[model samples]
Target: MVAITGSSSYNPIITINTTTTINEKLTPATFPQWRAQFEALLIGYDLIDFVTSKHQCLAIDGTKSATSKAVNFYWIRQDKLILHAILVSISTTITSFLTSCKTSHEAWAALTCLYKGKYRTRTMQLKEDLTLSTRSSRSVIEFLQAMKIIAYELAIIDHPISDDDLILYILNGLGPEFRDIAAPIRAKETSLKFEEIHDLLVGHENYIRRMENQLASNLITTVNYSHWKGGISSNDRSFSNMGHRHNKQAIHPKATPSSIQMNLQQIVQPPHKEKIKNGLLTLLHRTR
Candidate 1:
């Protein structure tokens, strides 16, 4: 093999692809999503080194050779492209403060300084929100989603909360009806992920709703059946009283067979048909 003269290879020039636009401009409230999108794009292109300061600019002076000048030009061009990407992605409110920043690293650091400074207060507020969250009338998925959003925000601010703590927060916020499920999860020694617990909670919520509906239906059916039976018993009592009174009048001590026959005939012709039929039958049977 031939010996290498200057070097085997040279560092490739890094370039930022400006065609991919960041969807939203940076604002105080939007920093987390905006940072994520921007960072992901930079990372995918392998140009994150510019903003992180891992790629430093070469120095240029009167003593520098043509090769040094060419390298410095390439570095400066790439830096300007990255800086432009950052400036355009920011809102006018924050971009005004970054006007003096000339390099990608400076802009990136400035943004972090401005937003990361508020992490302490923001983290406290997020924690409080998560702690106080309640399911109330909302669906289980909605409740879980709300809590997850707060957790995500916390993570973006560099204050990541554990899954177990989040699970505890969820159990605390749920109604007492969920105690059956909550107790077992609380007692488990093994670590559980959010996805597994999510399915369990949702399924349990549906079961509870079904049980409540079934109980309500049974109660209604019982009340209706009792009412119907009571109506039949009341009518029977009225008919029995009519029959007994007719029979008592017919068996009077001084009454003759003819008089009893006349009383039975009268009983068969009037008022309620069922009561009349039963009353006449009772009188005839007693006379026989």
Candidate 2:
């Protein structure tokens, strides 16, 4: 839990090392590899080591949130930190939440799929970072990103991020019956009285209504990610020039070419996690 500070031209950098405690917390019935990766991402880099300026930033990731006790270490970097302030689908992870992050409204059309619309407030999340800038430093893009971040991370509610047609499906599937449910009403706190029952009923109804909407929305998300799996974005122009939108339709029935490479860094690869498991097993076997 020790924090060390560093500085850069753009911002201040904070570093923390939680290896000792995190190693103790590692468990068998969990995503140990992901947890270890998170631990490394945290201790491996300086939490805060840059300037408190604009051009550059130095930040660290958090566990669920500053307050949440669950050691769900999050993946955060300067780029992801910017997700709610100024980002676009094409720009970077942070900017993707805002409308103005892209070059044109057309670009926004694609990025807009990430928006979570709870009727009045489209942001499915929120954020509180006093160090980055004043809350007053709000813009359409920043506003949206902040809102969605809060909603998804804090509320366990996510803004729908499917295609336009999927959005239309969500609206249609909601069937206008759930439209007037009034998010404020659902958000209101109820005591242990019958009011709680009433609120619960209302919540259940809304959830039931959302079932259809969610199903359709999920399909689009899957399709999008499926496309991404085939390698969607890359910096090399030559890669970009190869083709946009890896054609799912073009693959012949005869055979599937290309081994379908994956990011070895993520998912399957868990650093030396396997090695650790083997080492532990060896110790147990020798004792036996």
Candidate 3:
């Protein structure tokens, strides 16, 4: 196992490739090696513009004999993973909620927050906090609850959590003072968590709300109008349709006073040609 450290103190404790179980092969800019490179880069706190590759972690093919347990992709998922959590924040929507930073005071304050940073992506596991343990928990609810419990402790309530149901409902969340709080503490925790979660989430929902006023701002998302309007192909089709109609008036003379008085100059125009043009024009209009 190896360790990577940031140049400065502000960075989170990010550990990478801290294991000898590096089973896969490494490529210069390819899979396992690429991620190893990224781990190395993190040591200096340098921002990488793009991810170069994916690494392998497990192999599941029907390879050599008795047992078969494998994972094909080897990436930083283990390090990035916040997996194996027991409890977490409960929320209604994905994009609509804002999870707060995991802090030391959350458990004491009867509040909960997101364990990972906003820019981070992670997965969660569940716990036996009775409030959510027995009900039909959807994926989102289970996940939120697990994340909350991990970051903060919950106050224990007076309600009897029998020995048999200990596996089902938690007497208190995992933390230092969790076992001591009373049942009424549950209400306070629930209220604070709900309200703070709602408020923090609302902030994310309203992030830069009045976008209409930021037209000239550097952060504005601008798309080229000309690109959206399409190009010569679209314009040519429209012009071709109008051109067909315009040619008729240009070639055939109108029955105005001056037009009617004008001499033929040489040979008389063919009445059949004029009738043919007019007939074709009428046919086109009818078809349309």
Candidate 4:
């Protein structure tokens, strides 16, 4: 492998061409994903040695022939190409890790040591984050996605969280509103997948929202109905009271309709006429 890489005829373009565009750059949280992509790219180009420290740069010495200088030049070029690829894949914030590394092997070594050796610390932190996560005002999907990301981080560190434990963590964080479903999930004898639980929680969330809307609608309807009924009752009471007062005044004996009509007749008829009429009726009776 060293002889082949050191040959003047060997091209480094093969390694450059094999470079897969890493969509997700390296970050503390994404180390595992970044490393997998980078490693695969190196492996595909048969240039894994450049990063693995397997390919040593040919020595350029005063005693060496012109052929040796050609080998050294090509070797250095390939190594630098690999190193540049690594630098570009990493995020700017974390470039400090490779600041002192001059070659591909050094850069790769620095990153591996920093991430793999320090996994324990990151793993513990992620576990804590997962444990303390809550649904809060976020939707069920958002909440679950956050927890799942933590789980994935833990898995990358080889400290995978079991489904049961993960479910328990999720239930604990969902607050009392989801206790109905959470309790049932806890008591189940069969194991459930994360996807299944996610669906169930989302469905329950929708149901809760629907119920709240229904309750609000019902309350508004009840308030409007009561207000209408109260207005009608108030108007009816006012009219009834007014009619009762008028009837009471009109029916009093001193102010009755019959008394008014009799008074009117007494004023209109003359006293002499009534006496003359009565006398004539008596005389007629005597003749008969």
Candidate 5:
């Protein structure tokens, strides 16, 4: 009987496990996003220790005893298990490179080396992106979010940016709309935190929106007033035209049969004869 004693019940001496399935797996595309989480998982499973080093199972002086052989076999089995777990997390394309690695340590180092180069290149690209970032037509919030993402990626790679530099970059990238706020923040003797700058810029943006709304309201009021005035002017022109027509009718009254009939009736009426004679006399005087 093989005697097994260890602190944990699931120790390799007590139990050699079956297939290990991790909830979170790694792929080439997700390597950057999931690398930290995957590493944490590895640590949780106690498999990181195996990858970090090969466990010494025998005496240094090349001793070949039953105890040493059992210990070596235990180490080998554990290494294989850890290696299988890592391989399961990786994708087929990258898995090919790690297939030849006999020990877990070798596989881990190979993956690290491969990803580290890519990480450095990615870091450089992110740094360049941050340097060239601009607000342009983007909203203040949108611009800040983009810059912060680049900064975050750089920080993850151990190339952290200072808040002062970040503030300066933000100030530089801002469009003309934010100039008033950015100028004051830049003129300050002490460096302002990014949060302070963000608050000021956001406040200014809100003020701008309010002012825009007020201007629009004023414009609408002016347009409506102009339209009302135009309607009144149009009505006045219509009345003026009607008055002109009445004056023309007074100056050049049409000689119709009704006028002749009215004249005959007035001539026959003794009561209208005096008034008709007075009207004729006035007309003759005015014509002269």
Candidate 6:
């Protein structure tokens, strides 16, 4: 453990335990997420100033005075503590990168340059991702989230995306389903925030689902009505057939013996010439 007092008025004296507090080890692969934690730990112990060379003691004169010796001792002790803390916070692989460095400041610079390259490479990748992003295969929510992540990464690398640009990207990448939502947003006098746009998209999605459900219900109802009408038409034809059969039975009365004899007499009998003359004479007398 080492106690270091900060020269800055706002920073208080801090005690750092190299064994416990510096347990988070960093490597080339894990440097991005681990950098913040390591830097915060250094700041907490008030030793970051030493690593940045902000707290170096002034060079003493060649005289062997007690005050000069004391100043040299204090400077050496503070520098050693900061260097040791940095060493303990990284893995052996990362330590190899700093082996030639003799001071904490040198090691800090080396690490910053190494990670800056990684950061630049990451920044380019995020830019490409943002450029190639589309909503064709993913939901609107998923597309928006991916764009936001890319924007955040770009901002981290000192290349922040503007709100207007973000909105345009969202609109351009969206599927045709979102055109209605995009139209109104684009027509607005002022641009909507990302949150506002998200809400509007969600609302539109719900509306589309409701419309689809209503259309499906209507189609089902139409099919059922047609089926019912067809059944009624079949029943009407059956009733008409029954009525025709009933009328035929009413006229014939099941062919009793009297009705059979009448039908045979009409078919077999022929009228005589005298009978015809008598029928004509009877009609003339009636007219007179």
Cα lDDT, all candidates = 0.75, 0.33, 0.30, 0.71, 0.63, 0.65
- Residue-pair clashes per candidate: 0, 36, 22, 0, 0, 0
Better of 2 and 3 by TM-score: 2
Q: What's the candidate order when arranged by decreasing TM-score?
A: 1, 6, 5, 4, 2, 3
Model 3: weakest 10-residue lDDT segment is 82-91
Q: Comparing candidate 2 with candidate 4, which one achieves the higher lDDT?
A: 4
Measured against the true structure, the TM-scores of the candidates, in listed sequence, are: 0.73, 0.15, 0.14, 0.57, 0.60, 0.61
Query: What local lDDT score does residue 99 receive in model 1, on the 0 to 100 scale?
Result: 90
Poorest 10 consecutive residues by lDDT, candidate 5: 1-10
The reply for model 2, stretches above 4 Å from the true place, is 1-44, 51-175, 179-288
Report the candidate with higher lDDT, 2 versus 5.
5
Q: Decide which is better by lDDT, 3 or 5.
A: 5
Q: What is the lDDT of residue 84 in candidate 4?
A: 80
Better of 2 and 6 by TM-score: 6
lDDT of 4: 0.71
Report RMSD (Å) for each prediction in the order shown. 18.0, 29.2, 28.7, 25.2, 22.1, 25.0
Worst 10 residues of 4 by lDDT: 248-257
Name the best candidate (by lDDT): 1
Candidate No. with top TM-score:
1
Candidate 5: global Cα-lDDT? 0.63
Question: Can you write out model 5's per-residue Cα lDDT over 141-190, one digit (the tens) per residue?
Answer: 98888888878777766678998888888888886777777777877899
What tens digits encode model 1's per-residue C-alpha lDDT throughout 39-104? 888787677898999989978778897777877877787678779878877888898989999999
Count backbone clashes in candidate 6: 0
> Mind sharing the TM-score for model 5?
0.60
**Which prediction has more favorable TM-score, 1 or 5?**
1
